[model samples]
Target: MMSTPVANHEAIEKVRDLIQGIDNAMLTTMTSQGLVSRPMKTQEVEFDGDLWFLTKKDTNKYQEMLKHPAVNVAYVGKSYVSIRGEAELLQDPSKVKEFWNAAYEKLLEVPYDDPSLILIKIKAETAEYWETGNKTKMVKTLFERLTGKESEETDLNKTVDLD
Candidate 1:
């Protein structure tokens, strides 16, 4: 299996790019019964290793977090990123205004001040990422083409590990 560039800053940047470029992510939260997942709209703002979303405090997701704060955020595209983090329900009006978007008003049907409206803050603790045709793959492809040798597609899933 190929070793992921876990210590490489470039690799981290690539992972962040994938996460930020995506508009939707699967937020997996633990419920008293079992794991629950929901499609959530990612806020358009800087990540800084944290992901934020707007929601209602009365929603099942909020209730679930009150019981269990551990969460897994999944974003997949040409690559995949699985982020393990803790989620907290935030009620700060300033933060709400900072991440607020007019689109959310229409999407959630809740005003900024609606008592139910809340900010879900996910503070990532660890992450694992894998990509197809990233730098390493491109280099291999170039070398094989120059040598008139056919290259086999690499399996990245077998190469990834997280703390």
Candidate 2:
């Protein structure tokens, strides 16, 4: 129930650090069938209030984002971060080249100039993160849970407003 709003530069850096360690994230989109989530490789760039991903323009995810721009991206590592954001499909060739690499060429089997290649820019609005402490603290939490005792830890959860 403890949620601190992160607005300072230091706090923002901490959030960015946590996300930098996570290589992949689950992107959830709303469709006629309900909510659909798929694993997507996170772009290796400094987090600056937004996230980016590369996907085919003809994919269902691209269509879904067009219909319902609202999406959620979940990341897990030493900490868990849940970001609620809006996605926009961009065809900026310069941006594509900025994030392009040899790995992308191997995966798509096509050059960066391919027509189907597009970028998904997610502008994060609000994000919540839960960071767990070291092994000793984790063990204590487990012990408290097993004994049916309420643990007293209030500094592990935080929320940031990126807008």
Give each model's whole-structure lDDT. 0.76, 0.86
lDDT, candidate 2, 24-131, per-residue tens: 999999999999999998998898878999988879999999999999999999888899999999998888888889988998677888888999999987788887
Task: Name the 10 consecutive residues with the lowest summed lDDT in model 1.
Answer: 154-163
C-alpha lDDT of residue 98 in model 2: 84
What is candidate 1's lDDT per residue for 1-163, written digit by digit as tens?
3335664344445557767778889999988789999999888876665789889876899999998999999887766778888998888888887777788789888777777788899877667776654768756876887798876854444222222
Candidate 1: RMSD to truth: 6.7
